[model samples]
Target chain A: MTYCVGLLLDAGIVLLSDTRTNAGLDNIATYRKMFLFEEPGERAIGIMTAGSLSITQTTMARLTDAIEEGDSPKSIMHAPTMLQVAEIVGGMLSDVTSEVSAKMERMSQNATASMIVAGQRNGGPMRMFLIYPEGNFIEATADTPFLQIGEHKYGKPILDRVIAPGTSLADAEKAVLLSMDSTLRSNLSVGMPLDFAVIEANSLEISRRRRIEADDEGFSRMSAAWSEALRNAFQQIDPI
Target chain B: MTYCVGLLLDAGIVLLSDTRTNAGLDNIATYRKMFLFEEPGERAIGIMTAGSLSITQTTMARLTDAIEEGDSPKSIMHAPTMLQVAEIVGGMLSDVTSEVSAKMERMSQNATASMIVAGQRNGGPMRMFLIYPEGNFIEATADTPFLQIGEHKYGKPILDRVIAPGTSLADAEKAVLLSMDSTLRSNLSVGMPLDFAVIEANSLEISRRRRIEADDEGFSRMSAAWSEALRNAFQQIDPI
Candidate 1:
């Protein structure tokens, strides 16, 4: 299981992804799930993937291969807008998923994957999308300005109630971390050393990238604070 | 979709269930998912249902019928121990599920249902069980002292972090309400007018049952407070 979230905020985009991947309980491993594509001042995109590692890796490889094909790259870097970039990523992910699912079927296994792609291009608005396994996608709008992939439900409540387009970039990042923290507490399959990134609006450059480990002091502090607040709130409620 | 949760604590047990039943987004109606059977001071059983409403309703009716059986009451009141009561409920629920599934299959439908049964008999220890579609069930233990059925993921995080065998009964109730509150916010398929019940250890009877409506003031206040805390926490975090 994986938990990757992307938020579209007034100031920028915040992206976070867990690094744990497992074929079975005993076959756990850490694999970075976020991929960054940047041409410095030209374009910057961050993708956080979940589901089948095979499909996501392949899709991301294809995207990178295209970016490197820069005698006029035809990937997200060269796309006219973020929407087109989403279309390209969606198509690539879907294709890879179908191919991997077919191979996994031979062993009676299942292939499932999805990706969260967000960034700013030279000429387009900073955008965020939840690209499904089927190659179709939906963009974040003002009303619901964030998208999540992989083991989403455990963390969805916080996202739904608090995230919006007007949310500050700082708040948005905290929201995604808290959301991820929720998932981490509930699911053993999703462990840490997280991959986090931020892309300032109109910057056309990835502003920040972080690898948040399990023992990271900031995260530990945040979790403790949240738990204390919850305990406090629970005590305040009128008893039955 | 339904959301039903049961917590086994030193103080006793807490059972919570939402009442909304929907065939799809457009067709929804209210139906209580909780049923209580108490031969006060002798025993108290709280059955919270999720999944196929038809199968669950039938299962609940069967349990009630068994309790009212004069000659051979396969009832919680008559059972020698809490475990016996669990077996009776599990067997009946399993039987009803298969019968309904067979009938539904003939009409091109599916039968999927699950339940959380929490109860205590006068001479037995308090136990909470999660009965599966197949009728097999598992009791909560010290390490995992809670079970949730139907659309569980959305509300699971809070429970995972907050619930424990030693958790105060008052805290347990608040934990579940907050959990239900989270599920309600994220999954449209799971809705309001929830039924929440509490069983005090060794009391052999339910101590409280509250019906929280869509506009329940306490819930609204609690949600508002939670959101504010989240926002405040976000603001407190040092920006990256």
Candidate 2:
């Protein structure tokens, strides 16, 4: 299981993802699921993936190969707009899934993978899209300012309560973190070394990116503070 | 889809379920999912169901019929302990599922259901059990004070944050309501009205039973107030 969420707000976009991937209970491994594509002052894109790691890793490899072949139409940097970039990424992911699933067929294994492509073009507004395994995608709306993929349920309540169109980049990040934290505790399939990124509005650059390890001091403190806050909140409520 | 949660706390047991049943996007109907078999003061058993309404409704009807019968081994009231009650409920649910599934096989339908049963048998401590379709059940421990069935993911975060053996009944009720409200907003398949019951500690009887309809003033008020409170909470947190 994986938990990845991207929130589009008035201030900016926030992306968070967990690194834990497993083929089974005992086959656990850590693999980064977030990739950044930025041509500094021109365009910045953050891609977070959840689902089959093989498909996502292969998709990323092909994307990097395209970028390395600078003049190729398949490159993320040369994509005309955020929408096209999403389409390109979706196409690549779908292709990888199809190719890999064919090979895994004899083993009776599934090769499904989904990705969220969030970014901005130099001349366009920031946007976010959730790409499905079938290569289709959906954008965030004013009423639903965020889109989540993989093991989404365990963290949905907080997002429903706290996220909105006008939420600031920082607050959006916190919301996603708390959301990831909730998923981590309730779902063994989703584990640690969380990847988080923030894209400031109008910057066309990746503002901040950090990896939160299992024993990271800041995450520990935040978890403790949130738990204490909840305890206090419960104490203040008049129990019937 | 459905959402039903039962919590065993020191104050009492609170069971809540949303009353919505859907065969598809266009085929949704209002169907109560919470069933009660209480011989007031002697014993009170509250059962909440999720999944195939046919299986659950039939199971509850059988349990009710057995209760109404003067002499029968197939009754919740006649069960020796909370465990026996769960076994009886689970057996009924599994039986109903097998019968219905066989009938629906020609039409290619699946009879699936899950239940959370909470009650006290006069001398037994307030107990809660999650009965599987296979007649297997697990009792709630202090470490896991609650069990949820049906559209459980969306509402799980709140329960994880606030529920415990020490949590007040009022807070527990609020947590479950907010959880259900989250699911109601995110999943079109789960909706109102809702059935809520509170069993006071050692009473062997339900102290309160209420139906919260779509237009219920209090529920509406709570939902609005909660959304507002969340907005306030968001505003209070410094950006990031």
Name the runs in model 1 displaced over 4 angstroms.
A72-74, A106-108, A237-240, B106-108, B237-240
Clashing pairs in 2: A170-B240, A171-B240
- Candidate 1 on B133-221: residue-level lDDT in tens? 88888999999999999989988877877888999887887788888888888888888998988899988888988898888888888
True contacts kept of each: 0.41, 0.31
What C-alpha lDDT, on a 0 to 100 scale, does residue B106 get in candidate 1? 93
lDDT of 2 at A37: 84
DockQ of each: 0.50, 0.42
Query: For candidate 2, lDDT tens digit of each residue in A7-109?
Result: 9887888899999899889999989988988888999999999888878989999999999999789998998999999989999988888899899998997
Weakest ten-residue segment in model 1 chain B by summed lDDT: B231-240
CA deviation > 4 Å runs, candidate 2: A234-240, B235-240
